[model samples]
Target: MGGSGDLDAQLRAAMFAHLARVSAAHPDGVPSDVINSFRFADAPMRLIVQPGIRKPAQLDAALTIRTTWTPPGAAAPYADEVGPDGSLRYKWRGTDPNHPDNRALREAMRRQAPLAYFYPVARGVYQAIYPVYLVDEDQSAHEFGVDLGQYPNDEDDSAETPLDRRYTRRLTLQRLHQVLFRPKVLRAYESRCALCRLRHAPLLDAAHILPDHHPHGEPVVPNGLAMCKIHHAAYDADIIGIRPDRVVEVRQDILTEIDGPMLRHGLQEMHGAKMFLPRSGRDHPDPERLEERYVQFRAA
Candidate 1:
């Protein structure tokens, strides 16, 4: 009881800390065991907060989760039952659902319900800001990752304008992509710049084929290419380009006027060379997206 109480206090503090950081509209900062930083635009009601092994409830989306209940010694309110999904359904130990403790649990599950899913940034630290409400009960399985909903409480009451909501969502999505997208791209490219073949992680970036502002643009691995810092900048600036067919191209004027080794070896000589690609076909940059962006490069 004491341990659980202490943990609950810690969880509250962490939630507050996360709320403070995200409400300010900043990206996630340093995370500690008590709380995680989230963006203001993140889903408010359907979040995940994990408290390690003892706390077997894992939140995936809003109400989606994998929760566990162990038999208390030998006594239970009823015999174990299985849910429609083949999940086991375990009743609370108490006879009355209205029991104070049970009511408290239900209310907490409703109020604090995961506003956001909290995942580990490190060993003990977890991010927990998305809002979530456990809407169902299932227990047969050990893994539960379910979708709660798009908005915090099935509505967009938080934002006054749809455009404003979109803007905030975009910003928050970018913040999430920073942590989740780049690493996948880096690994997909084996930490090497697709153009220069530079293997330095610090100098590499996950360049998007279609700019994020594009309606069709997505931050999936297939939409990313690993490139060195200079190459990334040049690609973004339309100085260097990749065709949908996977060929590297340099601006004709720059190719003609540049004379240094940096020009010759860096950008010019690479023209017509096949861009390095990921091992998995699924992870390769989308040809359609590349084509769309390549048009802009050609115009430039």
Candidate 2:
């Protein structure tokens, strides 16, 4: 109770600080509590407040209050993300490399941080990126609906309440970008590289299905091919090509001037192989992306 009292003092200070900053829409005759509550919902705490005092709304003036946003010292980590299938993980975000949030919490931070806060690599996908920040346990969160204890991904036998669409929006955006380049290319190839069977991440590269610089176009994922690096470069230079049905086609131009065991070993040998398949059914490359790239392949 004593601690809560202290929290109220801090919260009150924050609330009034903002109230002092702006003129209330209903300043005239509004009671101090109502004025205070409204201010709490505004600047310095733009909490989406409602009737229940549990959220951003201010509660009974006499009752000790606290914000739900965790600060640097929170027992719970600062960042949390929930997945499409309802998976969740938490992390402490911090700038310092030596801090626990930076070291121990890095993985969770990548998974759970905000879309604005998360670093973006695949254009719009925020699924796997985050900026590190120090853990300050003293801060408050007016967006208090998320119960750190209620985070589901466990055998708690409890169901989540009031489905928060915030997470859903983020994941969908991320998945959409992957659709642009990945699944379509993998599917076009029938899921295996034409040359080597490098079935792992570190080795695979999704190359343009057409020569990178086709007169007809701009780049799109469908214009891609899931080939290993060797094949990717060869395909880009028209040294290697594949028909829409996945049969490999080597350019006669390369055959005469570049006669060698290396070319023969990689390109000529792959003349009749099929394309690689998409990794996940959901990740199958876009047919249009393939079609766009295929046209470039024909011209080259």
Candidate 3:
């Protein structure tokens, strides 16, 4: 039993390391082919199972849980909600709580084991969140409570007060929003910077036309712009702004600044250039939101 347990630990570590490398290479999301290609010591081992919950034959605990992406205005088959305490409320595989898959997940929670969570970012691609701990289960809801932002050592679940739980919930929701928002925005713009048309995915970001804290600031593709790091910083800092007409405008101070080639070509040369928009008109930056953001840039 000890030898088996040790091997399981080693295998889990290797799987995580492999996933980390894959994720680093594909920051947007991992393709289904790459996910299906994962192997352990020349043996077949799938990282994500079709049935949602995966309990590998070699391990006693559940290896992974997945949630498929649902289109807007469509009802999801298995709705994964956020619990009152901010943890993910993942529904059980079936009505039978004692089912093998449920039992495996329960055992994972009992042993405080970490597992991977595959969240869909596209039809056949997923963003993998790892080492997720199943903290508790809700019998009435027929679901397992998952914590995405913290580990067991981060806090004692039993000793947590309501305030602490609320704080955790806020942080978890924020992370969930970011994870879903970035890929969708980048995908809409074809993973290129809107200002300068930089094609490197790692150098790009999803910049919001309206700030997230604003009442109208929603995390939708129409309200986003795919921007490289420098342009994102410039947009946020009012060094550059985009007009409702889709024209780039460098701040007057920056336009006249006598500096290196970076300033001359990167910012000054970009002035009056037309912004590269998403192929789909529906995914274009919201004119209203851009006008609002432009107002701020003008005042700044």
Candidate 4:
């Protein structure tokens, strides 16, 4: 048993390292092809197991959990939701708590073993969040409480004040929204900068047209624009702006500024150029939201 546990720890560490590299290369999500190719110690070990839970034959605890992606405008199949205490609620496989998969998860919770969570961002792709701990299991509710490395495994939830719990929940939701927002927006734009048309995925970001704190701001593809780092910074700082007509505008001062080639070509030369919008009309930016944000840039 001791040797088995040790091997499990080693295998988990290798899997974490492998996922880290894959995520760094593909910030959006891991494609099905890449996920299917994963191996450890020169042996066959599937990272993402089918049917959600993965319990390796050599290990007593579950090693990973997965959630399937639901198509846009479609109803979700699972009732998975965020708990009031800031934990993620993952539903059980079936009604039986004693089933192999459920028992593996319960054992993982008892052992306080860390597991990787494969969350789908799009069809046939997943964003990996690792070192997730199963803190609690409610058989009657047919769900398990999951912590996404935010709190220590042994932390007492009951000790938290109501205010603290609310704050934590808000933060958790915000993080989740941001995570899910980026890939969708980037995919809509084909992983290219809307302003400069840069095709580098790592250099691109999903810039929100209206700030997230704004009442009308929502984390949808229509409310976002994919941009390179410099352009994103310029957009946020009002150094450049996009009009409702999808034309780029450099701030008057920046347009006339005397600087190195970067400022000249990157910002000034981009003035009057039209943005590269998504191919799908439904994915286009909202004109009203753009006008509202343009007002801020004009004032600045």
Using lDDT, rank the candidates from best to worst.
4, 3, 1, 2
Candidate 2 has its poorest 10 consecutive residues by lDDT at 126-135
How well is each residue in 150-254 modelled by candidate 1, as lDDT tens digits? 324445544447666445445544555455566568767877999989987767888888877778767888889999998999999999989999999999998
What's the C-alpha lDDT at position 160 in model 4?
A: 78
TM-score attained by model 2: 0.37
- lDDT string, candidate 4, 56-129, tens digits: 89889999998878897888777678875665789898889899999999999998899988889788898888
| Full-model lDDT for every candidate | 0.57, 0.41, 0.85, 0.86
RMSD of 2: 19.7
What does candidate 3's lDDT look like per residue over 134-223, in tens digits?
Answer: 877888889988877556564486688889778886677677777778878888888899999999988899998898889988777888
Q: After superposition, how far is residue 124 of candidate 3 from its true place, in Å?
A: 0.4
Better of 1 and 3 by TM-score: 3
- Residues 123-234, candidate 2: write the lDDT tens digits: 2221111121211221232111222221234343235333543454344444434333443344334445635655543345667554445653334445555677788888
The pairs that clash in candidate 3 are none
Q: Which pairs of residues have clashing backbones in candidate 4?
A: none
